[model samples]
Target chain A: MILTVTPNAALDVTWTVDRLVPRASHRVDQVRERAGGKGINVSRVLASLGHATAVTGLAGGPTGRLIRADLRAAGLRDELVPVSGDSRRTLTVVSREDGDATVLNPAGPRIGPAEWDAFTAHYARLARGADVVVLSGSLPPGLGPGTYAELVRTAAAAGARTVVDTSGPPLLAALDARPDVVKPNAAELAAVTGHDDAHRAAAELRERGAGAVVASLGPDGLLAHTPDGVWRAVPPRPLSGNPTGAGDACVAALAAGLAAGAPWHRTLCEAVALSAAAVVAPVAGDVDASVHRRFRTTVTLVPLEEPDAPHVH
Target chain B: MILTVTPNAALDVTWTVDRLVPRASHRVDQVRERAGGKGINVSRVLASLGHATAVTGLAGGPTGRLIRADLRAAGLRDELVPVSGDSRRTLTVVSREDGDATVLNPAGPRIGPAEWDAFTAHYARLARGADVVVLSGSLPPGLGPGTYAELVRTAAAAGARTVVDTSGPPLLAALDARPDVVKPNAAELAAVTGHDDAHRAAAELRERGAGAVVASLGPDGLLAHTPDGVWRAVPPRPLSGNPTGAGDACVAALAAGLAAGAPWHRTLCEAVALSAAAVVAPVAGDVDASVHRRFRTTVTLVPLEEPDAPHVH
Candidate 1:
């Protein structure tokens, strides 16, 4: 079973309009709502791909209830610790005509120290049964920047491989805990690696003690830095449409490949294909099994040079 | 004493930022929240201008608590009857360079029938002791379009003069109850009167049986159809800047003048001057007394041709 943690979950509301003219009112033609958080998205995608995934984190209020319902709808097991503050709503004004998404996200509910403790205690018990633990998204208000690092340490101590998908302070802090895997987009990798180029950014993350770093480059596809080699898996074709859940889909595929005992090259290949399939798919973080099989056939993973055993230096 | 009803008041949040680019993140520089509702604004301005104003309506939940706190901070007297649902929040994204306000208002809390009964009881009691009553803004969920009409009838039956400031079906329904006054901006007035132009709109409202119809024309100033005469008052200068609360300011000045037993000219002049002053003021619904005095020098009130019996065909 896989365990995923999302500290700051949200009720994602999408309002689609033909055009968004600032300061002018437009009647929203379409609206879709889902319980969302990075880790939850990854877990749902994994579940859709036939992986047993359990989600644990803080959730409460009406929005929290909706999140749980979404988890159930996605067929993912969820355990939520009740919180006092209302869940945050993230509004996405999707301009379909222009293919733009304007996000208005509220600062999520403030989680107290006690709530964090409760989550950690629950996670510890759940982590004991987990094969791989994924900690994703930003730390909600009141949590220290090092909260993800602490969770990474906890999961590692429980003898489970930990994967962290986050950026900024949490990403920087999690580096010290040295998770087995970390996925940051090219931009996040650049910031973390303190490098301008994607290649150097990937190399820098590995040097900072990430067992492996996956830098997702849009259209250019996945660039994986493993001990064996740096494999750049470009997509079969340049994909179009929604790119919202592409990374989460990649994370799900990578986790699935690792659990299935596929080699690093094979895992990276599947991840690229899964992400591409996700982009063209109607629902985010989901890929048809048949489409997954078809695309897996076309994914080509080519390896690059790894510096040395001192890839760290 | 003037009683203003804000059945569904909100904490209006205005986020001032640069251009809103979809899918791209923005750094919000300033966030301003205030007690908001057309009636709340009118009562606040009335209080600031030294008029005795009392506000009554429903408020509940955490957001409702904040609304009440803001009202107190603004030094406005309000009797917010507690209810179960969370009070609404209206988000206005204002552009820094351009004078544009993009509003995203939540459909307000659902008020049970019991809450409605309680409100009417208190409103009637409040009406009996007030110089005039102003029923404004929309009714919350679970109430019909005629909710404002019902309140107007109740206030009028209690021998209180009332002004209905609303639009759409509610405005039409309130007209049936024949409130002493109805204040709708040009667009709302046009919808109610089936007359898109200001002159025709005012005439149409009066014909439908409104004792006095006050039409707010932004920048162009205020127009009125009263028992004494037909009048139009233009601002001293072309009004520029924020127009968010200009209409409410007009209504508040109208209500205040009526309370003072001011004649048609004085009331129209005050309304037009204060309405213009509101645009020049830093905030909405607030006309600086100094600015009011300055603008008062220029507002020209003209008497239009009055209809015999003031009844429409």
Candidate 2:
């Protein structure tokens, strides 16, 4: 079984309005809701791909119960740790006139130390029964920044492979634990490695103790950095769909690649292909059957040695 | 007992954003939920005022359950008639820049004829025990236009003073039923009366067979006409607080006034005072005790006949 953790979970709400002006009212034509969190998205894709995934996180109030019910209805397994405050609800108002979306995301409930201890202990025990563990999303309120790294350390001791996908301070902390793999977007990699160039970004991220680095380059494709060198995996085309959970597809692909025992070269190629397939699909993180099968054929893999002067990311 | 009927209640979700634009994702600074509907607001106020009030409405799905749970938590007596579809959620986005609010109200769950029949029977029985009955709000989807009017007829037949607060065609339907009273805003009054002038509007609404017509004139207070004569109940001050449910506050005052056996002269004055108090209160339908008490004394009840048509809303 694969385990996924989302420190802060949310009921994501989106509305489509004609236009949004300051201090003005807009009639929203459409509204949509989904059980949301980076780890939840990844686990959903994993389930759709025929993998058994167990999700654990903090949830509370009526909104928390709703979120847990949604996850169960979607056929995803969960162990929700209830808290006192309501889980956050994020709003995305899409303006049709301007072709842009304004997002209003509530900061999730503040989790106290006792709650953190409960989750950490429960997750560590749960990890003992899992082959792989995924520590995803931002740190919930009241928890220390090094929370992910501690979880990785605990899971590693339990003989489970850990994969970390996050950004900023949390990602920086997770690097010290040397998770088997770290998947960061181009921007996230740049922020962490302090490199504008993708080639150097991958190299610097790998040097920060990530056993391997898989940098998602949006339309360009994927960059992989290992002990041997660097490799670029190019997809057939750019994904064009609602850009909400595509990154989770990359994370799912990376986990699946690791599970398949493929070589780094082959794994990175499959990750890029799957991510591209998800982007072109209607819903975020959705991989069409035909595209998934066809993408396996066209993904291009190019390998290179680590440069003598490791490029500054 | 003041029984308030909210046929299609909502879980009102309010979000505060810097600005609103269509098709754009906005970062909501704050998100909160409360049970809402015209009659629901009136019931909340009545409950606050220490009046015995029972709210009946359709509620379903997880959201519907939350609505009932919240109403109970707020110490409001409610008995929901469960239905098939999910209860609706109303999203009110407050953008600070323009001081305007955009409302995305869900077309609430479709109400089948069976639900309607069940509610009417349930409500008619409840009405026999009530001193006043308020049938409020617009028609939800799958409901016929004259639903409120039918509810009004049922309440009146049960010997309860019936008050209808709705607009457009539904308002027209209730008028033909000759409800005890109809509270229409200036615009709704104009639509019902076929006249833009406040006095003419009141006459037209009264001609439609309502026992009394109270045409709200916003900051100017109310233009009221009863069997006795026309009168104006003027507010002591024009307040700046949000007036989302001020009209409902007036209707609630009307019910409480009628229950207290106040004559039209005093009922109209009390309604004006409650509305002005609502305007001055920070939250919707919240009539400040001090403000409400103070305004009760300042509301001028000027008889239309004695004034000689000089001026007054």
User: Poorest 10 consecutive residues of model 2 chain A by lDDT?
Assistant: A304-313
Query: Over the stretch A206-277, how does candidate 1's per-residue lDDT look in tens digits?
Result: 788788898888878888898667888988787765565888888887777656667888888888888887
| Global lDDT scores for all candidate models | 0.80, 0.80
Cα miss at B300, model 1 (Å)?
4.6
Interface Cα root-mean-square deviation for all models: 3.6, 3.3
Instruction: Give lDDT: candidate 2, residue B136.
Output: 83
- Residue B42, model 1: Cα distance from true site in angstroms: 2.5
Tens digits of per-residue lDDT for model 1, B209-233: 7999988878888788988888878
**For model 1 chain B, the run of ten residues with the poorest summed lDDT:** B304-313
Off by over 4 Å in 2: A14-32, A79-85, A94-101, A193-201, A302-313, B18-29, B96-100, B190-198, B300-313
TM-score (all chains, Cα) for each model: 0.81, 0.89
**Clashes per candidate (backbone, < 3 Å):** 1, 34
